[model samples]
Target: LPHRYPFLLIDRIIELDIPNLKVKALKNVTVNEEFFNGHFPEYPVMPGVLIIEAMAQAGAYLMIKKLKAEGADGDFTVLFAGIDSAKFRKPVRPGDQIIFEIEGLNIKKSMGKIKGVAKVDGQVVCEAVLMAALKKS
Candidate 1:
């Protein structure tokens, strides 16, 4: 990803199925996070928007990896075009590890749509449908 520390929410790509257009990634939430300090110094719950961002990052990873496998060339970056049906079911806090599962719903040319779900301890915390555009950087 083009993100750096404190912004790059994805910690690892645990699974990738290129042919299936699916990916699974992890993000370990910690009290040391900068957002935690401002989001809530006392309670420290992870922001809902960041969870959605994490899902988007996972989807971006899947698209990038697929492009690589297909021998596509270009310094590309994925940018959010839209987010739909986003729902936050539970709060995420320090010491929680979020697992993002993203599946491509439609991908053609520069536009793509993906369904993403964020889970902690096998329970869904958030889910959304993300739309993005792949642009050459």
Candidate 2:
């Protein structure tokens, strides 16, 4: 978590549905964000890639949390194995509350699959299918 900088993407995780292996997190976007300066000077807009990254981070957090709950110790890293069928449906601007939701599809010994979505004010902003794997520390 400390590794994140320039304002963390995740503000808080509201729900963790263990039975379904799903998680819900939030990110508050503001106009003063640094990325807006270069992304566009006149027509500032949040980058689409960042939206996907935010979703991916939420998914990673869930995987790490589950691993920790299962009594896994030491430093274990979860890496993004692949991104499939990612789509940016709408532009996410400042002053938006992005609700990120991720569901665990399959979790094996080291690899896992998750379906993630980012919503702004109850509207879908982005969605993606992510595959991740745990790496040896």
Candidate 3:
């Protein structure tokens, strides 16, 4: 979603409900990830920040897609506006697949807020409230 490899975290979108403003996306973790090299050489764990970024990206994607589906007239870019109540509940390692479940909390002409949960094996690993704004691309 407008993101290049290594920086783009979403691998696939499993479910989407644009009207409800909810989506479920996946990211497969692997040793090949560049962050694994220095995040922890001996005992690698996916960085918490990256997980949060993944959540934000998923939220942004949702905004972009919904706007497109609504036939927005201009080229718009979704930008991360804020993050709140971010929590890391567990460590993410290689072989783990993060299921990002995001629900829109509020959306407006320019700004939007969404709540996201990152899960691994049905257990939540991280959660946050993310905000974004629409801007000229």
lDDT of every predicted structure (CA atoms): 0.92, 0.84, 0.90
Kindly report which residue pairs in candidate 3 clash with one another.
Answer: none
Q: Which has the better TM-score: candidate 1, or candidate 2?
A: 1
lDDT of 3: 0.90
| Candidate 1: pairs in clash | none
Deviation from native of the Cα of residue 86 in model 1, angstroms: 0.1
Give the runs in model 1 whose Cα sits over 4 Å from its true position. none
**Which ranking of candidates, highest TM-score first?**
1, 3, 2
Off by over 4 Å in 2: none
- For model 1 the local lDDT of residue 75 reads 76
TM-score of 3: 0.95
RMSD in order of candidates: 0.9, 1.5, 1.0
| lDDT (Cα, tens digit) per residue for candidate 3, span 1-137 | 77888699999889889999998999999999999999899999999999999998888878877787787777777888888999999999999999999998886668889999999999999999998988867
lDDT of 1 at 39: 88
Task: Show model 3 residue runs off by greater than 4 Å.
Answer: none
How far residue 105's Cα lies from its native spot in candidate 2, in Å, is 0.8
lDDT value, candidate 2, whole model: 0.84
